[model samples]
Target: MFSDRLGAAAQAIQAQFKHTLGQLDDVPVVRAMRHATHGGKRLRGFLVIESARLHGISSAQSIWAATAVEALHAYSLVHDDLPCMDDDDLRRGKPTVHRKWDEATAVLAGDALQTLAFELVTRSEASPEPAVRAELALRLARASGAEGMVLGQALDIAAETAEAPLSLDDITRLQHGKTGALIEWSATAGAVLAQADAAPLLRYARALGLAFQIADDVLDVTGDSATVGKAVGKDASAGKATFVSLLGLEAARRRAADLVSEACDSLEGYGAEAETLKEAARFVVTRAH
Candidate 1:
């Protein structure tokens, strides 16, 4: 059921993307933007939509927020795959933006996508209240900018040339910034939209985000490139410290399961309405990509 819901969400988001991007100019950068966002699990967007659902928000309104998060996520992946960053040639089982297009096109596409995320979140369709839209934009900026994802990326790059591998605590802190920030934003977007308290979703997202990163580390070691849709074992090959490297494979798996439990527990107050989210948490650690 969770898988079905996830698939539906992905389809809806992709449709939104096509409709939105279709209005843009026909250019290489625009094409690259479309390509960069073509496929993925759409987990962050699903979190946005599902969290919004829990708050009784209509899919009509929440789809904008969900699409915004996915656009931003796509932008991040495009940049991450550039030569100066992760330098990968594959994503979502296809050639990455930089590989499919020129580097300049990729850069411009990523920039355009990032800006489009803010535009979508701030659109009148996303929310009737200007304050809510403004709040979403503000939080999105913080999550995707210097204080969040960028900071994490900077730390990751720094770790590459550090005197020694990062300690577990160090890696955790880094991941909290890089991966956890946007996830927290996505998971809490519903409450924000409804002007309700986001504390429970925040707690759930923190655990889920960390677990998501741990799962990614596990996949890097245990998954193949075809299944992962990206380069595998890059961290190990680069001698980069990861959860699997720091805690061994089985230990990392157990830790992910524990975190999934913690995430589900944080949703207890929502009762049966939160089952989909709980299933999503479990799915994170078990997914191949």
Candidate 2:
């Protein structure tokens, strides 16, 4: 059931993204945008849709938020892969946008995708209530902007040049902004759309997001580039501190498992209705990529 829901969400977002990108002229920038957003686990989108389902929201209305987050995520990836950034050569098992096209086209495509995210979330189709749409757009900007993901990225960049590796506390704080912020937004967006209280889901997401990053660190140590779909062992090579670096491998694995348990526990209010979410948290730690 979890796989089915995940697959359905991925396909739905892909169609929405294709339809939206189709409106633009067939050019390199547009092609790059399409390529960049083409595929992923679509876990963020799934969280939005599933959380919406838990709140009795319609998939039609929730799909916009799903696609919006995916577009924003794609933008982050494109920029992150640039030579000046992570200098990654591959993503999702395909050539990075900057590698496939020129740097100029990659930049433009990322910029376009970022804007498209807001457009998708703010569109009337996303929610009948203008207030809800406005809230979604506002929060999305906060989650993706300097105060959130970008702040984390900035800190990460600075850490590369720091005299000492980051402490566990520092990395946790950084991940809260860089990765946790968007996950929190996606998980809570459904409650916002339905005018329901989001505190529970917000708690769930905070634990899930950190555990997700810890799992990535674990995979970096244990996975190969082909299996992980990107470069592996980068933190070690760069001498950057990560959960695996701070905590031993066995300890890091235990921490992620504990966090997944915490994440699942946070959904107790929803009972059986949240089984997929529980499964999702488990998957975050256990996934091969």
Candidate 3:
């Protein structure tokens, strides 16, 4: 059921992106934009639309938020795969944006994508209320900016050079910003749109996001590059600390399962309406790629 919804979300966002990008002039940068945003699980976007549905928000309005999150996520992946960053170049089973094009084009495409995220979210058609649009844009900026995802990336880079490997707590903090922050925002987007209490979804997202990363760490150890759609085993090769490294394989898997349970429990307030989200939590940990 979740897989079907996820696939539908991916298709919806792709159509939204294609239509939005069609307004731009035909050029290499535009091409790069299309390339970078082409494919993904679209989990973040799915969370946005699902959360909105739970809140009785219209899909038409919520889709803009969903697309915005996906765009920002794609931008992050493009920059993260740059020569100066993680370097080795594969994403979503294809060449990383920098490798597919050039580094300069990749950089510009990422920048434009980031800006376009805000443009999509703030459009009057998706969200007519100025305050709601502002809140979404503001929260997105914080989640993706220095204090959130960028901070996590910076810490990750620093860890590579640190004398000692990061502690478990350190990695948790890092992943919270890098991975968890955006998920939290995505999951809470409907609550934000509706001006409703978001505490439950926020709590659910925190657990789900951590479980997702733990699964990533586990996959890094057990997954093949072809199946995972990116270079696998880089963490061990780099000697970076990860949940798998710190807790051992079985323990890491156990921890992810526990987090998934917690994430599902956090949705109790939403009753049967949140069953799909609960399934999503389980899927995050069980997915092979």
Candidate 4:
């Protein structure tokens, strides 16, 4: 059921992408934007939709925020795969934006997507109340800007040249900013829209985000590039410290499981209505990509 819901959400997100991008001028940069945002698990958007559903928010209103987060995520991935960054050639089993186009086109596409995220979230359709739209945009800016994902990314790049490998605590802190921040925002967006308390969902996201990152670390160690839809074993090849490298594969798996349990437990207040989110937490650790 969760898988079906996730798939449905992914479709909705892709359609929204098509509708939004179709309105833009048809050019190389716009095409690059479409290419970069084409496909993924759409887990972040699913989180936004599911959380919105839990709050009795209609999909019509919530889809804007959901699509906005996905656009932001796509922008991050495009930049992350640039030659100045990860220098990856593949993403979602296709040539990355820079590899498919040029680095300048990729950069412009990423920038456009980033701005589009704000445009989507701030649109009147996303929320009737100006306050709610403002809150969503504000939180999104924080999550994706220097204090959040960007901070984590900067730290990660710095780690590559550091004399010493990052410690477990350092890695955890880094991931909290880079990955956990946006996840927290997505999970809490519904509550923000409804003016409900977000504490429980926030707790759920914190654990889920860490588990998600650990699972990614595991995938890097064990997944094939084709299966992963990107380069695998890059972390190991770079001699970067990851959960797997630090805790060993079995221990890292155990830790992710524990985090998933914690994430599920945080939804106790929502009872059976939270089952989809709980299932999502479980899926995080078990997913191949």
Candidate 5:
């Protein structure tokens, strides 16, 4: 079904990035790049591709957009693994950038990658309009900056010291800041690129982001390294706020399903062009990882 196509696209995009990373001369940089790039469903890139398709945009344009998203995603993961962040030793089943290299090197590498992502978008062949490309870059910046990902990470660090139990709303807000904002942009950036105007797309992406976060929480509770490519139950062990922690597993799972249904319904006007996005909604809730 959609899994096969989605998986193929994800795998292909990762491979392309891996090839690019191989050309770098620095060992630590190479290792960090390789570690960050390995193993994942390139969901953000898929969103860009599918969103573009919905507006009759070609795959050629989507490829470059996908590449930029992938680069930005890798940069985020590398930083997330640093001692200042998640402080992890593994990502996608391999040693994290900080583990593979020194912390300073990992940090610099991530910083470089972040800038490179913007560069990618600026020079992307798929970008038919520089202004639009810049706008998309701004979207990514907003999604990944203090207003979005960084703020969420800060809250995550803050929660580590709080004595009180996390409320459901607390969990939701954290995820909305962390995972949901990025995901919402990832889904809608394509629509933005396609020049497709619709209020429902925004609504769909918002719900889709929440659904994606809930599903991640479910997977963290229920998945394993083999399927997830990262440690399972890490959230619980880290005492991080999650839907499953506040809503209960059953409730979180139900919410995820509901969000997916709503997301899919939002694309009713798109017909077959939105099949990838429709299937993506299902994949979000159903994914093992």
Candidate 6:
């Protein structure tokens, strides 16, 4: 059901953008945009909708929020795939944005997508209040900015060459900044839109965020590229910091389980609506794809 919801929402969003976005040329920029936005699984969007439903929020409003978050996620992938970042050649079984188009075009496409994300949320058919839109924009910016993802990435790069080996704590800090913050924001944004108290969910998101990254580490060590859709074992090969690097695989797995338990506990009062989210936490640790 969770995956179904994600796929259905992604279809709707794709329809919403079909033949839109103005004069899209066949230029490198447009190609980059198409590559980055075309095939995402849109897990972030699903989380938004599901979390909103848990709080009795309108589906339309959730859709607006979800689409906006997904756009930014697409933007991040575009930039992350650049030669300057992950420098990957494939994503979702296709050439990455920068691999299909020139670096400059990829960069511009990412910028446009990021800005478009905010615009969509603010202008949605069932938008949140202006104040809510403002908050969303602020949160997204902070999550993507130097204080968050970018900085975390910088830490990752440096740890690759730093004199000291990365500790488990360092891995947590990096994950919180890189993967965890966006995931948390996606969850919190949904709660915010529902006019629900975000505190519990935010804490839940934090634990889930860390668990997700640790599971990513395990996958990198054990999964194949065909399943992951990206280079596997790149961290170990590159000598980068990872939960696996800091803790042995067995220990990392245990830590991820602990994080999942923490996440589930944070939902003490959310009742059955939170069942999906609880499953998501376990899924994060156990998924093969």
Cα lDDT of model 2 by residue, 1-289, tens digit: 8999999999999999989999999999999999999989999999999999999998998999999999999999999999999999999999999999989999999999999999999999999999999999999999998989999999999999999889999999899888998999999999999989999999999999999999999999999999889999999999999999999999999999999999999999998999999999999999999
All models: lDDT?
0.95, 0.95, 0.94, 0.96, 0.78, 0.80
Task: TM-score each candidate.
Answer: 0.99, 0.99, 0.99, 0.99, 0.92, 0.93
Question: Per-residue lDDT of 1-289 in model 1, one digit per residue for the tens?
Answer: 7889899889999999999999998989889988988989999999999999999999899999999999999999999899999899999899998888889989999999999999999999999999999999999999998999999999999999999999999999999989999999999999999999999999999999999999999999999999899999899999999999999999999999999999999999999999999999999999988
Clash list (residue pairs), candidate 1: none
State model 4's lDDT: 0.96
Model 3, which residues run further than 4 Å from truth?
A: none
Candidate 6 residues lying further than 4 Å off, grouped into runs, are 19-27, 124-128
What lDDT tens digits, residue by residue, belong to model 4 across residues 208-275? 99999999999999999989999999999999999999999999999999999999999999999999
Candidate 3 global TM-score: 0.99
What's the lDDT for residue 97 in model 2? 94
Candidate 4: 10-residue stretch with minimal lDDT: 173-182
Alpha-carbon deviation at 96 in model 2, angstroms: 0.3
Clashing pairs in 5: none
Cα displacement (Å) at residue 59, model 4: 0.8
CA deviation > 4 Å runs, candidate 4: none
- Relative to the unseen true structure, what is the C-alpha lDDT of residue 49 in candidate 5, on a scale of 0 to 100? 69
Candidate 4 backbone clash number:
0
